[model samples]
Target: MHQLRTRPARRLVQLYAGLVLYGLSMALLVRSGLGVMPWDVLHQGLARQLGWSLGTVTIVVGALVLLAWVPLRERPGLGTVSNVVVIGLALDAALAVLPEPSALPIRVALVPLAIGLNAVATAAYIGVHLGPGPRDGLMTGLVRRSGRSVRLVRTSIEVAVVALGWLLGGTLGVATVLYALAIGPLVHALLPRLSVEVPAARAVQPVS
Candidate 1:
């Protein structure tokens, strides 16, 4: 039997690499003791509720979201598919490797760090020409079926999650705003150059 070879665009490869790097940066962000992404805030809440490691919660959530992608029949392409596992795995490992930060100064520093990491992650993620993240996928599917704009759907979801996570004792701070405002442009700027291939179809846009 002969093995078939598949060649992906260079840009896709760059995005894949970016995803892994972003995962690493996220681990540091969490460890920095500043704050976390809203989704991660939920993960922390779920971790406490379920009595599991944050990493375990990440894996569970990511897996559940990835499963939803099946129905969309959206082509994840190579980079997006890799993102599902790589981000989760790298996040878990990075958490273990990175020490939790001490003092308010370190935490403050982490805000920028997390922001930068997210930008890189977004850049890589978008580059894949694959489907969006599980959460993003949900929003896109909803919009396509219901004729709602993805922006509204995504904002609603992010607000709800952040609120819930905050109520559940997740830290909400400057980092949250940074994640919201900075990540988009950075990713937009970086994505085009990272990979040579563009998706034939548009994927759900990333929310900063």
Candidate 2:
């Protein structure tokens, strides 16, 4: 998109803000104790196993995911690399400040709120079109290589991750299932509205 290239400041702002909010949303979900998204399940499990901070596990996992990109021929962009670092740092920061609520009802309420916020954050960063995060790029790459439906590839990948993470001692709860069901529709609804449109001339350019 021309706007993406030309309005670097706005795009950067959107990218960073989206990433920060994404991390915060993850923290919210963690504090809720309702479980987390698929990749996060793995992160949490690794954190527990290694006795490391969740954010540390997140960054490590992100880097490892990026390593998988090599065989897939997935190129990392500024946003992609930033995603590996910023989200982890932000999550740590958020977790540091946010207290875990004692009330069950309050914890329950955080689930939907975290899910909604995560969707918005996802759309915001993706709309910038700088690049897909490592996990997302892995999904797209697999779909390309295997010639499978996005739904099939994504579901298969997630199912495997959740299973492995659960086995590794991650929290698997109703929220995990709920988030899987809800995020697709929410991102679909939000992406068009959130996406930054390119000028007509730039629309025809080859996407990098």
> Highest lDDT among the candidates is held by which one?
2
List TM-scores for all candidates, in order: 0.81, 0.92
Tens digit per residue, CA lDDT, model 2, 1-208: 3435656787789889999999999999999998998888888888999999899889999999999999998777777888999999999999999999999999999999999999999988887777788888888888888999888999899988888889999988889988999998999898888777656543221121
lDDT to native, each model: 0.68, 0.86
In terms of TM-score, how similar is model 1 to the real structure? Answer: 0.81
> Candidate 1's residue-wise lDDT over 88-114, tens digit each?
778888887787767778878877877
Instruction: Please give the lDDT score at residue 86 for candidate 2.
Output: 93
Error of 2 at 170 (Å): 0.4
> Candidate 1, after superposition: displacement of residue 163 in Å?
2.2
